[model samples]
Each structure stands twice: as C-alpha cells, then as structure tokens.
Target: MKIFLATGNKNKIEEIKKIFSMENTEILSIKDGIDIPEVVEDGNTFEENSKKKALEIAKFTNMITIADDSGICVEALNGAPGVYSARYAGEHATDEENNKKLIANLQGIENRKAKFVCVITLAKPTGETYSFTGEVHGEIIDEPRGEYGFGYDPYFYIEEYGQTTAEMKDLKNQISHRARALAELKKNIDEILK
Candidate 1:
C-alpha cells in the first residue's frame, strides 16, 4: 500500500520514513513529485494542524495521507513557540534564527522545563481520519549541543540520555516525539490499511 506524507520538509520526511518503514508499505512525500499547494497551519493546536494537512492532501490525491505538526513547548513561556515553532522569530525563520530567539527569551529563567510534542493524523479519501500524539520531556539549554538532528534538537536536553536529540543519532529514531507517534500508528497499521 502507498501512503502519502503530506509535507515538504526534507528532515521531517527522512525522520518519518525511517520510523514508519514497513514491508510492502511505501511512503511518498512532496519530494516524490506530488504537487499540492501548501496548507495553511492556523490551528491553535498540533492535532488540528495535522488533521487539516492530512485531509487536504488525501482529498487532493485520493489516497491515504499522513500529516504531522510538531513543536517545542516551553513551560516557562506558557507553552509559547508551540504552534509557531517553525516561524518563532518570524515567518520563514531559519533554524538558527528560531533557536536564537528561543535562547533570548529563556535567558536568566531557571524553569527550563519543556517538551517536544508531535501529532500525526491519518486521513482517507473518504474523509475518515485518526490521530495519534506523542511527547518527550526535556529541558531547554542555552547552548546548542549536538552535530546532528534539526529544529530545536540541539537545545533540548534529555536528562536520561545525557545528550540532546541531535547527539542521539540513530537512537533518536526510537525515542523522539515523531518516532513515538509513528510507533502508535504502526500498531494500528493492519486495521488502517483494511
């Protein structure tokens, strides 16, 4: 069965592909020559955004579609940069820019509690949909500390691993927010594919 991943971000595509790998189940993304207009993410929550993207793409391609909306939510900031994680500094903000803005906003603040949240929505052409959510708790560090991963990975410190998500390398595929969410999806794959 073929599944359309409704996103153009290369990093997200790679991560999802790795976690959702299955025999006879092929995953395709925007990079696979699927031409669809970008979906606006004006939702107040991750689930809403994920469902919106999934439904839109499923309707357009008449295929089973999956979409995810994820972000770093800081407890101190009242979960700010939540839905706007991608464009925290501004629309089209680069990773570095968003990280910088996050650091600045967190300066001198002792409460560094934060969590990475991911919501995945699966949609069928008939508009039937299901959603899954996953989260990894961590603290926000002032200095970025890894050579791999993207987005807020370098700044997210996992106490148990003693390393940021970026430094975890392959281990990230097992424990990251997206990975956990995909794991949930995989558990129900048989029923969803029917």
Candidate 2:
C-alpha cells in the first residue's frame, strides 16, 4: 500500500520514513510527484492542524495520508511559540531567526523548562482519521549547539541525554517527539492499512 506523507519538509519526511519502515508498504511524500496546495495551519492546537493537513491531503490525493504538527513549547514563555513556533520570528523567518527570537524572549527567565510536542494524524480518503500525540521534555539553552537536526533542535537540551536534540543525530529518530508519535501510529498500522 502507498502511504503519503503530507509535508514538504524533507527532514520530517526522512525522520518519519525511518520510523515507519515496514514491509509491503511504501512511504511517499510531496516530492514523490503528488502536488497539493499547502494546508493552512490556523488551528489552535497541534491536533487540529495535524488532522486538517492529513485529511485535506488524503482527500486531494485519494490516498491514505499522514501529517504531523510539531513544535517546542517553553514553560517560561507560557508556550508563546506553541502553534506559532514555525513563524515565531516572522512569517518568513529562518531557523536562526526564530531561535534568536526565542532566546531574546527568554531573557532573565530562570526556568528554562520546555517540551517538544508532536501530534500525528492518519487520514483515509473516506475521512476516517486517527490521531496520536507524543512529547519530549527538555530545557532551552541560551546558546545553540550541534550541527545536525533543524528548527529548535540546537536549543533543546535533554539533560538525561547530556546533549541537544541536534547533537543526538544518530539517536534522534529513536527518541524524538515525532518518533514517539509515529511509534504509536505504527502500533495500529494493520487496522489503519486495512
């Protein structure tokens, strides 16, 4: 069966593909020749955005589609960048800009607690959908670290891992929020594929 991942982010696609590797099923993405307009993520929460993207793409392509809305929410910021994490600095802000803004916003704050949240939605062409969520707790560091991963990875430090998400390159796919969410989705793969 063909499973379409409704996202243009190559990094996300790669992470998801690695987690969802399975027999007899092919994971495909926007780069796989399926052209669909970007779905507006105006939802108040990750679950809403994930479901909207998955359902829209599944219906558009008449194929089962998977989509996720993931972001880092800082405790000190009161989750200011929750759903707006992608455009925290501006609508067209780059990762560096966003990271800078995040740091600036946290100035003088002592509590650096934060968590990365991921909500995944699996949608069928018929509108049937299932949702799963995962989160990874960490602290936001003022200085960025590592040379891998994307977005807030460099600033998200896991104490237990003793490294930032970006630094845990080889171990990311095994313990990331996205990885945990996909693992939950994988548990129901048989029913989803049927």
Candidate 3:
C-alpha cells in the first residue's frame, strides 16, 4: 500500500521514514510532483491541525494520509508557540529566527520548564481518522546547541539524557515527542488500516 505524508518538510520526512523503515508501504511526499494548495494551519490545537491536514490531504490524494502537528510549549510562556512553533518569529520565520525570538521573550526569566508535543493523525479517503499524541518534558536553554535535529531541538535540554535533542541524535529518535507519537501509531497500525 502507498501512503501520503502530508508535509513538505524534508527533515520530518526523514525522521518519519526511519520509524517506518520496516513497513511495506511506500511513503510519498508533496515534493513528488503532487500539486496541492498550501494547508492553512490556524487550528487552536495540535490535534485539530493534524486532523485538518490529514483529512484534507487524504481527500486530495484519495489515499491513506498521515499528518503530524508538533511544537514546543513552554510552561512559563503559558504554552505559547505551542501551535505556532514554525512561525513563532514571523509568518516566514526560520528556525534560527524563531529560536532568537523565544530567547528574547524569555530573557531574565528563570523558569525554563518546557515540553515538546506532537499529534499525529491518520486519515482515509472515507473520512475516517485516527490520532495519537506524545510529549517530551524538558527545559529550554538560553542559547541553541548542537547541529542535528530541527526547530527547537537545539535548545531543548533533556535532563535525563543530559543533552539537547539535537545533540543526541540516536536518543532523540527513540525518545522525542514525534518519535513517541510515531511509535504509538505504529503499535496500532493494523487497527488503523483495518
């Protein structure tokens, strides 16, 4: 079976591909000449956005489509940048821009408590859907670190791992929020497909 991954982010594609390395399904992306309008992600929550993207893409492709919404939620920021992680700095913000804004916003604040969250949704052309959510608790550092991973991974410090998500490539793949959500989805793939 072929599945459509409703995203244009190559970084996310690579990570998700790793999780599904053993699967027999072929994962297709928007970069494969599949023309579609840009998805407007104005939902209030991750699940909402995931559902919106999955359903829309599934309908457009008439195939099983999987979409995930992920972001970093800081306790002190009252979960701000939760759904707007991609554009935290601006409408067309880059990772570095968003990180800089986050640092500026939290300057002089001692509370670094934060968490990364991911909600993955699977949708069929029939409109039926399944969603899974996962989170990784950690602290945010003043400056970014590491060169691996994407988004806020460079600044997300996992105390237990004693390194940022970007710093621990192998560990992040196993314990990150997106990884956990993908793991859950994999565990129930049969039911979801059935």
Candidate 4:
C-alpha cells in the first residue's frame, strides 16, 4: 500500500516510516511529485487540523493520505502551544528558537508540566476519514538536554525514562509523540488499506 503523508518535515516523515514498519507502505511528500495542495491548518484542535490535511491531500492524490498535527501542551500554561506547537513562538519559527522561548517562559517556575500530543488522520480517496490520537506526558526542563530528536525534545523530560526525548533519541522509535501515534495507527492500517 502506498501511503502519502501530508508533511514537509523530513524528520517527521522518517520517524513515522520507522514506526510504521510496513513493507508495502511507501511514504512520500508533496515535493515528491504528489502535487497536493497545501491545506490550511486553521483548526483550533490537533484532530481537526489532521483531518483537514489528510482530506485535502487525499483529494489531490486520489490515494490514501495520512496527516498528523501535533504539539506540546504545558499544564502550567493551560495547555498552551497545543495545536499551535509548530508556530508557538511565532509564524515560521525555527525549532531552536521556539525551544529557547519555551525555556525562557519557564524560567524561575517550579511547575514544569508539559506533554506531547499527536493526532493522526487517515483519509481515503473515497472521502472516508478516520483519526487517532497519542500522547506522552512529561515536564519541561529549565535547560535543554541531549542533541538528538527535534523540536522541543531537548527540553521535554520523560518521567518514565528520567531523560529528555532528545536524550532518548536512540529509543525515540518507542517513545516520541509521533511514534506513539503510529503505534496506534499500525493497528488500524490493515483495515483502512483494505
């Protein structure tokens, strides 16, 4: 089965591919001759945005398309930067810049509550769509840790692992938000593709 993921981030694509592990599934991007129109993610929720992207891409490709919208929600901040995770700092902000701003915001605060959330949507050419969500609870650290992973991984402290997501890069295939979402997704792919 050829699955075209609606995303421009190579890191995200690679992570999803690793998590899925489907031999017949081929992940491709919009730049890979898919020519899917850019879907506007104006939704206030991750699931909404994921659906919009998946549906839009599926319409264009006339094939099965999977889209994901994810972000970090800080408990102290009342789940801020949730759906706005990618553009948390501002529109078109780099991962490093966003991570820096996040750490600055938590300066001198004790409650570093945060969690990563990912919502994945699968849309078929026939207009049928299904969604799945996954999350990993953790706290934000004052300083960034490790050099692996991407986005806010360096500052996200996983209580279960006692290390930041970046620090667990080698094991990210088993822990990150995207990985978690894919784990759930894998169970449904067989039915969706059929």
Q: Per-residue CA lDDT of candidate 2, range 87-113, in tens? A: 999998999999999999999999999
Which parts of model 1 have CA positions greater than 4 angstroms off? none
Using lDDT as the measure, the top candidate is 1
Enumerate residue pairs that collide in model 4.
none
Superposed on all Cα atoms, the candidates' RMSDs to the truth, in angstroms, are: 0.7, 0.8, 1.0, 1.3
Please list the residue runs of candidate 4 whose C-alpha ends up more than 4 Å from where it truly belongs after superposition: none
lDDT of 3 by residue, 71-162 (tens): 99999999989999999999999999999999999999999999999999999999998999999999999877898889999999999988
Candidate 1 lDDT over 1-194, as tens digits, reads 89999998999999899889899989998788889888999999999999999999999999999999999999999998999999999998999999999999999999999999999999999999999999999999988899889999999999999999989989999999999999999899789878
**TM-scores of the candidates in the order shown:** 0.98, 0.98, 0.97, 0.94
Q: Best candidate per TM-score, number?
A: 1
**TM-score-best of 2 and 3:** 2
With candidate 4 superimposed using the best TM-score fit, by how many Å does residue 14's alpha carbon deviate from the native? 1.0
Worst 10 residues of 2 by lDDT: 185-194
Query: In candidate 1, which residue pairs clash?
Result: none
| lDDT of every model, 2 decimals | 0.94, 0.93, 0.91, 0.86
Of models 1 and 4, which has the larger TM-score?
1
lDDT of 4 by residue, 6-38 (tens): 898888878887787688667777657656666
